[model samples]
Structure formats: structure tokens, C-alpha cells
Target: MHRFANPAQFNRLADAILPWATGAFVLLLGAGLYYAFFDSPPDYQQGESVRVMYIHVPAAWMAMFTYMVMAVASFTALVWRHPLALLAGRAAAPIGAVFTALALITGMLWGKPMWGTYWVWDGRLTSVLVLLFLYLGYMALWQAIDEEEKAGRAASILALVGVVNIPIIKFSVDWWSTLHQPASVMRLDGPTIDGSMLMPLLLMAGAYQAYFAVVFLWRMKLEINRRKLAVARQVSMHAPVGAE
Candidate 1:
């Protein structure tokens, strides 16, 4: 881990890993989509609407995972001053934001026929909405600041502060009576969903995980290239300073 903290070492490892990740991402998503659309059983209550869960739940899970990745990376950046950690935060924000948006959009689409409304201020929905805003705010902070160091610092603090809301979002359904269904897959009493529905849900979750990996790696590679260009420009500008 420490060895890979060096950019040269990181690049070597990433170069080896990226191809494998790309292959696995495509393969897993293809299988997951097949299973989700064809293999899964419809719920007796929700009928076909439960199929939306195959997509919606996984998107929501990824949304939460993305923020946690950012928060942890932000902490690492602030504490150890690791550039990769900061890159991780930068790489994760937009991906997480996309997942959040997907979750909300899919939920709305699912909600309209089932819940009678496309929008709700219920506990779970509201908290998730706040999480989406947090991601947007984090990205905005990065773009708002001109100085790289200051921007990273500011973004790191904002990420850390927003982490307080993650737990709130997770437990919101449990804490309050809401339109959103309570936890079925992760409850203390074990999963309430039958195996027929569960398998596709798991497959879709894997697909979403692969999607996160693909996007995160792509963003990190882009950031590294951007940094290399900046360094090259700075070197060209300072060429005469030490030579003279």
C-alpha cells in the first residue's frame, strides 16, 4: 500500500489493473442485467414494479458507498497529505453524484405508480436528497477555488462535515414512519426478501460496484494526466530560474 502511494508505483499497478477491471466491469454488468430482467421473480405485492428495485436499490447502495469512499479519502488526504487520497476524493464525487441522481430518478419513476406521487418529503427520500446536494456542494467547492491546495483542503473539510449525514440517511426509514420501505436485505432479523428476488438484487449490486470502479479509475487517470501537464508547464516556466 505504501509503495503504491508513490505515483510511479501507482501508475505501474494501475496499468496492470485497469484492463482487468474493464473486462470484469463489462462482464458483470452484462450478466447482472440479464438476471435482473429475466431471471428474477416478481413480488406478489409490487408485481413488475419490484423489478425497478433491481436497479433502484443498487444505485442507492452505490450512492452511499461513493460518499464513504470520498469521506475516507478526504480523511487520508488531510491526515497524511497523500495526493492519491485527494485524487480518490476527486474521482469519487461525480460518480457518487451520478449514482445519487440515478437513485432519485429511478425512485421517482418507481414511486409514481406505487406511492401515487413522484416526489415526497419522507424521511428516507429527504435524507437521500440531502446526500445528493452534499455531493454537488463538494464538487462545486472544488471548482469554486482556484488554488489546488486550498481547494483540496476546503473540499476535504466539506466531505468530512457531510459524513455526519450518511448515518442519518441510512437510518431515516427506521427512525421515522415513512413512505419508503424499511430495510429488507440488511435487517437485524436477516433478509425478508425471498431467494428468487434476492439473487438478482445481489447481481445488480455487483454491476453497480463495477460501474463505480470503472468511473473511479477513469477519473483518477484523468486527474493524474492533468497534474503531469501542470508540472510540465511549471517546469518550462521556471527553466531559467535555477540555471542562472
Candidate 2:
């Protein structure tokens, strides 16, 4: 891990991996969408509307997965003062926020057709709503501070604090009486879903993971470049007049 601490090494590694990651994302996403729309059978109860599960489940997984990534990065940044770790956490914020929004929106679309309502105050729903706010608050905290180090510290602290909510979101249905269904795919008894539906769901989940990798690498590279430029400008400003 420390080998990647050097910005130059990290940039080279990111460049090498990005093409493959992007290709995997595109391929998996296309295949997943095809299966979801055409190959996968409709639910016995929900009928055609069940197709939305492919998108909604994957987006929901990515939302939580991205937050976990950010929180882990934040922990590393805080504990080891790893520059790349801080940049990774910072870069992941917007991506996680976007995924969280997609989850909420797709969930509402699914909910409306099945539950006869677009929104509900169920434990799972409310916890996910809090997650969205947490994402926004994390980003807002970063932007609110002027200094980079200070911002990183503040955001990292908030991220660690907010991670407690992740378990709450995952187990809300089990822990409380809610409209949300209990775990189907991830349970002690294994997935209760059919193979036809599970395949597309897993495919879409892989696609979303690949997409996150591609985006996160791009953002991390951009952050590194931006920091380098800032340092260069600061050095120039402090240099003697006419000094190169």
C-alpha cells in the first residue's frame, strides 16, 4: 500500500488499470441491461414492474458500497495521513451521493407501482434517506472549509461518525416492523431469488462496481493534478522575482 503513496507511481498504476476497468464496466452494464430487460422473467407477483429491481438493487448496493469505501479511505487518511487516502475519500463523496440519489429515485419508482405510494416512512426507507443527507453533509463539510488539510480532517471525522448508520440501513427491516421486505439475496439461507433474476442482479452489481472503480480513479488523478498545480503556484508566488 505504501508503494502507491508516491503520486507518480499511483498515476501510472491508475492509468494502466483504467482502460480495463472502463471496458469491463461498459461490457457488464450492456449485458446486464439486456438480461434485465429481455432475458429475465417477470416476478410471479409484481409482474413486469419487477424489472426495476435490477437497477434499484444495484444502485442501492453501490450507494452503500461507495460510502464504505469513502469511510475506509477516511480512516486511513486520519490515522496514517496518507495523501492518496484523503484524495480517494474526497473523490468518492460525489459519486456516492449520485448513487444514493439514484437508489432513492429508483426505489420510489418501484415503490409506487407495488406499494401504491411513492414514498414511505419505513425504517429502511428513512435510514436510506438519512444516508442521502449524510452524503450531502459530507460534501458540504468539505466545501465549507478553505484549507485542504483542515477540510480533510473535518470530513474524515464526519465520515467515521456517519459509518454507524450503514448497519442501521442494512438491518432496519429485520430490527423493526417495516414495509420493506427482509433480506432475500443475502441471508443465512442463501438467496431466495430465482436464478434468472439473481444473475442479472449480480451482473448489474458487478457493472456498478466496475463503474465506481473507473470514476474513482479518474477523480483521484484529477485531485492529484490539482494539488500539484496548487503547490507549484504557491512556490512560484513565494519565489524571488524572476526566479524560475
Best-matching candidate per lDDT: 2
Compared with the true structure, all predictions reach lDDT values of 0.81, 0.85
Judging by TM-score against the true structure, name the best candidate: 2
After the best TM-score superposition of candidate 1, give how far the Cα of residue 190 lies from its true spot, in angstroms. Answer: 12
Q: Per-residue lDDT of 63-85 in model 1, one digit per residue for the tens?
A: 99999999999999999998888
Candidate 2 stretches with Cα past 4 Å from truth are 1-5, 168-191
TM-score of each: 0.87, 0.89
lDDT tens digits, residue span 1-244, model 2: 2433599889999999999999999999999999999999998778999898888888888988999999999999999988888889999999999999999999899888777789866665677888899999999999999888789889999999999766766577446643444432222123378999988999999999999999999999998888788778887899999987
Each candidate's root-mean-square deviation in Å? 4.2, 4.0
